[model samples]
Target: MSWTVHVGTILHLLDPTANPRQCLDRLWEEVEKWTSIDGIWLQCLPGHLQPSGTVLVGRCPDNADEIANLASPATASLNTDGLPVVARQLRDGNVPVALILVSHHHQPQPAGFLVDALSRYLLDRLRLQLEASELAEENHYLRSSLTPQVMQHDILTVSGLMETVIRSAIRTAPSNATVLITGETGTGKELLARLVHSHSTRSHKPLVTVNAGALAAPLLESELFGHVKGAYTGADQDRKGLFEVADGGTIFLDEVGELSLEGQVRLLRVLQERTITRVGDHRCIPVDVRVIAATHRDLSREVAQGRFRQDLYFRLNVVSLTVPPLRQRTEDIPLLINHFLQKCNRENYKQVEDVPRKVLEILQAYPWPGNVRELENCVQKVVVLASGNTFHEDLIPPTIRSYINEPHPLEHMSLGSSHSQDSSIPQNPLDNLRQALEHYASNAGPNIGECFHHIERLLITHALNKERGVKLRAAKLLGINRVTLDRKLVEFDLDVKRGIGVIEPLVDASES
Candidate 1:
């Protein structure tokens, strides 16, 4: 007589999505149906990582407990009472990973070899399911590790300051009141302006933008209030300004503090009367426009300094939104890093998908004076310069790396049971001096003169890089006067390259 079982029939018995216990239970029913099997079980062996020791699936339910005890890997090949045991070892290389145990109660069993072969095939099928399950688990772990927050209105942030700014923008968007947005130059004031306009009643109409500081003070008036034919040089035809263009919509005036006193008076009039008069024309053109102004300068201070109009400042400050700088909101840096990583990957035709934790720490410690825009530019440069998928410390500019790369004695200290948080801060001046003295003691000589030289050069170079090579700014950042900074610059032989102040790090030859 010929026994019968097909491959598809066996596959249907084992569900890959189910646990091994469920798979074995379903598989055993098929085995007992097609053969004269009394019992069958899978026994776990060493290195399987399977705490699921044995799965019994066949008949002999009355003596199931006794049979299961014998089915474990230690007693897998033992026959109990009148049953005979036939086993197949599942080997991963030379080591046994599992044992497929089968029991029967007939002499001269022809199906014994066939059952062993079937057990091996079933175990292989289980291996496939295990591999797939592991892959799914790994993907989920990766996604959880990557995202802690989501972007709202294309703005990704978790900081309370930023959330407050966004909430204010949303709450104030529906009104016609002029909004004054203030922040550092790169802190995304214009983005908040667009957010306000997009959620406003005037969203469907044109939204005009002008860089109030980026124009000549003489021409700024014509640019905002427009010019008629023959109003001035190059005024050959009738022209409408940004206010006219943005009528019935919203207009964003960036760097509004740069507006001249004359321009400020006209702006205040337009705010008060809802009308504008063209240059060389007296007729007031009524414009139903909402103005949103932004500035990196302190308008209140500008007003106090008498350079800006107080009335205009008050008119524009009906609603105010101040964006916090990135350094103040360091908690959001990780989310921003991943956001820019994926964005730069698509734009640069690169695949820098990995951002390790050390990179995050280094970036977090930085006082990003330039804010979000600088971070995005840093990430973009890193993506372009990346040689592989992972980001490395060397790819980051020396200006940023210097903050984290500095020598600190407290970094490795055990503190001898001190629990105070102050112990974890960077090495103090005295501690740093002691560390240098000890190091020099262990060296060939006392290079005290050279030690100070290394520090001065490194600091000057770092400051120049951080300030992007502006001499006055770098000197201010370093807490030194211009003459001292210039003298040091000459002494260190630090060349200030044109167009962005690139200064190479001056490494000591002895240290190298």
Candidate 2:
């Protein structure tokens, strides 16, 4: 069938080049010359609305309104003056664009095939052009900017500690030496590994990651070194392992400490010889792959205790990088909270604005056991359950609330009486604190830190109360800066109003 392909509205993409208006004028000029048509219809909506497939693009020879009416939902297929009009929707990056082909003969399937092929090529060209434009803009911005920017990745960190880590990772990424990432679980070890892979010369190749702790000994071995057909009971067909799959790329071995003794020997041999022998196979097949192993366990300790092999440990420890736990770098919490909140909000379709100051204090106070992973989960939980834009202290997990609810150590300081007011007590404040802790410890709660935090809150409140709500005076009395005193006031929810320091208890709503 003889057919003429017509371009419909291009969705999502706007002309990014300089002088878009002139470009559009020139585009129409070329279209008229190519199609031998005078003009076509063009519509640019103000907001992000899906383009109707029947909307005319450029200029239509027939009346645009009449054509739209003829191509309405009721008129699926049509014949206009012995010409068959077929329209199909094509998606470019989830944005749909309509492609119409008018054929002199009635051959719907072939016309559709031709339209789809043409649309695919158009979409591919558009994507390539868009990417090129973006890259050029990015290069220009980076060259003009003074600050060094991290490569585009999901990692969000403003902490100096993380900046150093990122710099180190970038520096070492090009090398082929095995990298050993040591950190507590959820500290973004795998993310760093992937970052290294992305920056490496072999970035164009595959990256296969396997969790050494997740599988049994035999399965882990088979997964790492492949298996021949009839090698085991379930081996119906020969299978390539992760090493083979990751050839010319990087293979990340997470929780490498969990590997059994035999598995360690096999891994060490592979690292040394750059080859692997399939299960039940004598032949040693050469494979080229970089190894990036990670674990929370201390490999040196494991080796000393005979749980892990010394040679294998040495092989993987060529370039060791330690990721610090979240508690040590609490300064990054605000940035992290903002990042994860935006993420969870988008994913959960919520509109959480920010974490309230009181809630931030609680999150900052609690020692994150699961590190960044736990913090992310906590943010997700709060966002999913948030009733409004602001996240309050009450939304925090009960364990945290309970931990912050200790007796303030300086509770008696507000009484304005010396410890000797009772003859049984020592005059020293430290003595008073010790006695208070002993009494509180008798109740058997989580830890001493929780009790100590209570004392800290009490001391700050007493200082504020003594100063009659003047932050400057309170900071001087507490021997701290105004910034620290302000933080303490927020942490303890100590509202200083009307010459009084009122402590707001972080009580669970259910209990209240």
Candidate 3:
């Protein structure tokens, strides 16, 4: 966090050579007390100066002739060189560098050539300083902002694929090549485009996005390439298109595969020539723009089917990236669910606690056809409906409920099998019934009839256990009219009172 400032002074007159260093030293002493500054620099004679941990020196020429004459055996060796050497050193330093040109006196204007050279040199240094500072600040900010987002976007759980694409995109962002991002519809292809733009040299400029699918062919072309006045009936005044507006920046073409063949050809020509001809004007206006295209459709298949031009496909696919769908990474579902729940809570101004284990199981079991977008919507719905601290099964969308009831692969077991043998423990009838009910309830089939039957049996068994075999009391405990419980007992062909009093024949004999 230490900030160092390099100050270089060029002495034009040699008459007061001894006093120049003294003046620089005094300036350094004064600047040292400034809290923001960590260090200072004082240039002694050309190519020679003292060095300190907090201060250093270098050779600075006062005029172009002096600069031209000073040279060294090796370029790395600092000598009395021209402004180029100073510029190189300033760039090499980690901290900001400032150039101060000292004349014999504080004249209103030094000689024009001297003033011009000094001004140019100072400007160059200032530009470098600004660029370095901007880059540092941006890096720091992005690290803080994007570190947490990595978890949010990691929902796809395809970190390897995403990392490869991100790294490749970053490497190619500075170049003029067009990038094509292809993926399933909710896989965040547009987000990837923004990421590329953010890391590119053109990040300072606007990233204009155009949804090709939303616009008609003619309008799409005009929107992308601009239209001149009187080009059409509705054309009132000259208009700048996306390409013109996104000059020196990136133009993100979303759903680029939806573009008509003719539009694709025009876009291809623009990419190839780096120029665009307005809808009406015959003149071609050169545009400097980076093209980043995204599409959910399979462009290659579209090209093969003659829907998309092969040439245009090749032009746009200079660097292709594929974002993986969410289902492929089941492990990330819980993480994504949490992120969506938090987002919903913030938007709706509600406090939601933990997602119930049953709800999570339901979410994980269902095959998400709409991908991440569907999952996000599902979470929002649950958050909206949630009342208590814990989200319950009732909050889950009906479409996902069946999956949660689907029987596990290990549900069926024979009585003599290892699983049944370990689970079978001689115990009170109520205890055995409770265990059986728990198992059946947890393994309820996806069929609603089967699930309902399991739930009703569990409720009856629990009530009977609580009433200790008293049929009338058990019926009352279940909150059912006595006649209804009596009908259920007869329907199940079970004498609730007798069954509860009876013990296992083997256990009774052993006790005797």
Candidate 4:
């Protein structure tokens, strides 16, 4: 078998002498040429320039570098500055810089050493360019990938918040304190319980998991604390209960909120005494086991309602962990999408290159009521239905479409109630504006200001869409003059000259 070697080429341009407009034009040309290369192309900007010009320097892969190098030396010299100029343009334009890795596999040739060295050189140059670039957004992909793997069954993805939870759970797992993993249904509560057990000191011991809500009172009692022969009409043979079986290990009780009062009493006894007696037999058996419980229902509320035991709730919640909903961190959507797509490709024996921008936009905009599990199901459906490299928006489920189109009641201002509501709410438009700005600011990293610019552009685009791409109407709706809107269109980096024939219906039409 021939050994495969992966080659990566990265080109970096440091300082350029050309004007911003010329720089951007040159950068786009170079990026187009390097589209087929097996590496990334990068451009850097000078530190002293104002943050108004396009910040992106030119970028292409190794293959593109080869093509550029093959050109006349005079042309290559211009091409060399091309990458830096693009980086400068992107910085000035305030576009968020996303570092992406594109991989390729090829059989090594006799000159592999030279090629490999060149690749390393290119990567070094790219890193230098990235450092010198005006944007300071940090990369988390590598750090995220290095997170300790949980039990394969426990967590589906190692997202930032999930990683924090897992790491915290690992540290607390060895102790005998009861662990409560809380989240919405299908958010992997049981998985977190098992992960706690697997990482605990009792790794070699058994882990017995029971669904507290699945069994009737009598059966659940026998299943948990075991039953002696002739304990009940059907009990003909002696059997160890979950607590007994989990000796020196862990016993996980899932859906703990569903446990009846009687069941909770028995469980509380076992937890407090560290011993259990089989039904129909008076002899108590001592067992050393850690208890990890999970629940989707709000146990505190259940306790308040007298449905669940308060003592049991307090015991189980010794170490509480809450899994964040997928909607809370929309930034992870791309990573999850790529992960699911790769899995589908492997299983279905199909190669898919691109996920259409519209599909991602819909995904980001939709509120995932069922969280990650629902998102995974949607991905599976898309993969099964996909016939080409691109995933079409039509393949998305109607439920997601409904979410995207759902009207916001707040958007409509009732003239009668507006005054009273405004009085009660005390119209602090400046404070509300500040809060919104801060929320976006905290999440946007170094590209906060740029991201804001993009958001403003998006708002303008929405206005244009509402007016059916009529510039005058859009400008009027936005409360800006046509000339001002035209300048804004350019500032937002929108293509004003292109016909807006393909604009989609505003997902949030009421808001628009």
Candidate 5:
């Protein structure tokens, strides 16, 4: 039999008759060098030596000549001084006739028939190993290729609102325009910012990020525009600010609404002049960085309240992207849940194979206030706590589990309400409404019909406010036709446009 030995290749059979005990010890030591595994198992006949079990053997780069000499068909007991060899007997229905050698990630052993055929043993093992290696490489390639697809799957939604947001983000990604992403907290503002940076021309450069809300005004200033040595109390060394670090790339300013008035001014200067001055130094350094700001706060409202500057708001609002809250895109819940489940399995090493239908329904119904971030946490929790392969309601966190199968008042009026037809709004809203009516009645002294009108006016106003002053949507929430809504608007002296109503005392105009 001919056996070839070379560097970088695995599999080497030692002399047929080697000192079994010593050979086993050497083989184990050698295998340990290649991978971390439990002690080796030696299976062989009791009499004259027979090799068996599994052994790992990789050629050494430094000593190929020595290896060839050791492996030469010499009538020697497994040469302890040269290459390592192992001996063992295969279990019932399985025998190691051909010396099986493997590296760290070993391939499956060939069938017993294939192993016994001396002529084809080497070729078969080599072919199997090559195929296994190729399969492993292909698997790695597929995983890497699927990464971006998974990300897109997680974000892309069936809802038109989310599709519009994604389309807008794509349209703005390639441009050099400053982008301001607004949404509720945990709505993936930073994630969208990263998407913009990844698709932009500046993708090749760094995308430095800083949370404006995380740092104080002074520290934040230093972080934005690097300070020179000795600029402040502990300014030991000159530091390059985020803008400088992101000179040819994009700088993501997260929670930008949290910036102090002074911080806002400095940021404004960077936007307007394309330059930033170090804290201590008066030198204005030109920067070619693109600014991508994100916040959960309404900057327009902030500007109105004198908290945010109008000019800065306009500068950063060059291309505004509003990431829809998860509740608004409930249709994507199943996709996201599955995506997160796969992610949890990989990260937590838990094989939660499936999510139960009831669990999925509950997850979709619950309003994720923390948005995608909250949903991710929920999935992770369930995966970690799941006792079996399937995720169940019992595995969910208490807060989410409690809400499962429970109806909420807000679900009744919102356009993006849950789809469970059997779910009815809790009577809490009605109870609260009744309490308000009694309080108002004691003060106004109105009769039954007039009181009913006042209550209808209050409900309509509430719906209109919730619908952001959209008359048609408000009418839908009130279960009334648009004509009826318009008449109610006039009767209550409600200005739908202003989202407020002026009601003159409910006079019995019929008595008049």
Candidate 6:
């Protein structure tokens, strides 16, 4: 087979997410499988300005010879003496990332093209592994730094009502009493649950969250009290419920108001007895767990109407905490906007440091019917499209822009601009891809591989832009998860390195 075909086959054979040592081993194995050759050796250069002495031996089997350091990278690339080896050094944005050395005992083998192809493949995978490690560390640091003070300062609130709620949460977190949190849909009832779990004695254990409202009666029973094999048609194996999984931990049952009468009886039995029986089994399993429930509805009123059982209501409402909606506390709007701005900046890799005064006024005036969640969406919109350190009137969504009397930018720019008259949102994904392709083809010539990679990068960019840099929404648009999208952004240097709509290849696809 031609070496180019081997290159493509190599990608399919190797795991892209493997670490340097693992990837190198897989590469060596694949190469050995496809070619009859003696053992091989590989080297990976240090990245992110790390030391040259720290350059890694990508893979050196216990029996393989150590001959990678015989010469410098430049000399190593051209060297052919001693072991009669083929070597290649590959770089990313000018920093050497890997060196490949494929050799055999005095025989002319699949030597030259294979070494170069392997070097390119190994380089990209190594960078991904290293970046993944670094990102993991960074994320852990960010998470660990979310102390109680920071959580309260950043997200809880500046309102006296919120302060009262937070104070109650703090005082009640250390106890085992059941907590019933009430609030509007987007007012962060889940956050309150987390705060309680983090401070309780069970903090080290799991916090299993269940949306009780989403499940039907039978499914809810089976989910809360797991089933044995053949409990139902779909019961293929024995399973554990969220409560059992959360043994010695806390279970946060969200939207408890929606649980049916039968589900309520099962839950009440668990709360009263601290035991659960599998759906098919009569044997009872004991558990030690704390319960935290949240609902947007008033459970008391439901009980008064006989829609909810008073006994279950009294069992769950031992302690109550309510979160006020954004409209009730307009003073917190600016603080929340800034808070979301910082968060989205880190996520989308933007540097928006300021919110314009007039824009803030318009945002504050809006009713924010969706509560803090909607306000956050609005902030994310402005931040992603800001293009600078401050916000502008044009960046605001039309829904929010409708609050004021000033002429919309679309109306003024309608004379010449091609943006939609109704909204600034981009067209459908297919249109975005077509326009991106046309733009890419107009600016530079790309091979099939490069063309495909460019299209992927553009779609990710367009999806992020369309969703206002909300990674989850953008991922939904691209049919990928947020983690996958993050990896793609880093892989292609699309995060901040290439600004929105810029079509430049950081590395050739064959090499990437």
Query: Judged by lDDT against the true structure, how good is candidate 3?
Result: 0.59
| Model 1 whole-model lDDT (C-alpha atoms) | 0.65
Q: Write down the TM-score for model 2.
A: 0.53
1-512, model 4: which lDDT tens digit per residue? 11123333433232368554454444445544332323333333334322222211223322222222222222222222122211111111222122222111122123344334434545665554544331222223422553455224356554545667778888898788888888887666777777788888888899888888897997987888889899889899999888889999998888888888998999999888988999889999999989888888888899888999888888788999886666544545666676777787888887653665556667865657787678878888887888876566888898997756554332332212212321212122222334546655665668766557634654566455333344644555566666898898665555432113114321221233
Q: Give the root-mean-square deviation of each candidate in angstroms.
A: 17.5, 20.1, 26.7, 20.0, 18.4, 21.6
lDDT of 6: 0.64
Candidate 5 C-alpha RMSD relative to the actual structure: 18.4
Evaluation by lDDT, superior candidate among 1 and 5: 1
| Model 6 stretches with alpha carbons more than 4 Å out | 1-154, 404-512
Estimate, for each residue in 119-236, the C-alpha lDDT of model 3 and write its tens digit: 5554554565554455455435433443453653232332444555667767887787799998888877887888788888898999999898787876876888889999999999
**TM-score: which is higher, 3 or 4?**
4
Looking at model 6, how many pairs of residues clash?
A: 0
Ten consecutive residues with minimal summed lDDT in candidate 4?
Answer: 84-93
Better of 1 and 2 by lDDT: 1
In model 5, the Cα lDDT at residue 424 comes to 18
* Model 2 stretches with alpha carbons more than 4 Å out: 1-153, 407-512
Candidate lDDT scores, in order, read: 0.65, 0.63, 0.59, 0.59, 0.63, 0.64
The digit string of per-residue lDDT tens for model 5 on 66-176 reads: 223222122233322233333222111221122323222134233232223322433454654554455456435434444453457246445555667777888888999
Alpha-carbon TM-score of each model against the true structure = 0.53, 0.53, 0.49, 0.52, 0.54, 0.50
C-alpha-based local distance difference test score of model 2: 0.63
- The residue pairs that clash in candidate 6, if any, are none
Clashes of 3: 0
> Candidate 2 residues 349-453, lDDT tens each?
998754545466566655577999999988888898899766657777787677555433333353334322322221223345556567556543776776677
Using TM-score as the measure, name the better of candidate 1 and candidate 5. Answer: 5
- Model 3, residue 254: distance off in Å is 1.0
Which should have the higher lDDT, number 4 or number 6?
A: 6
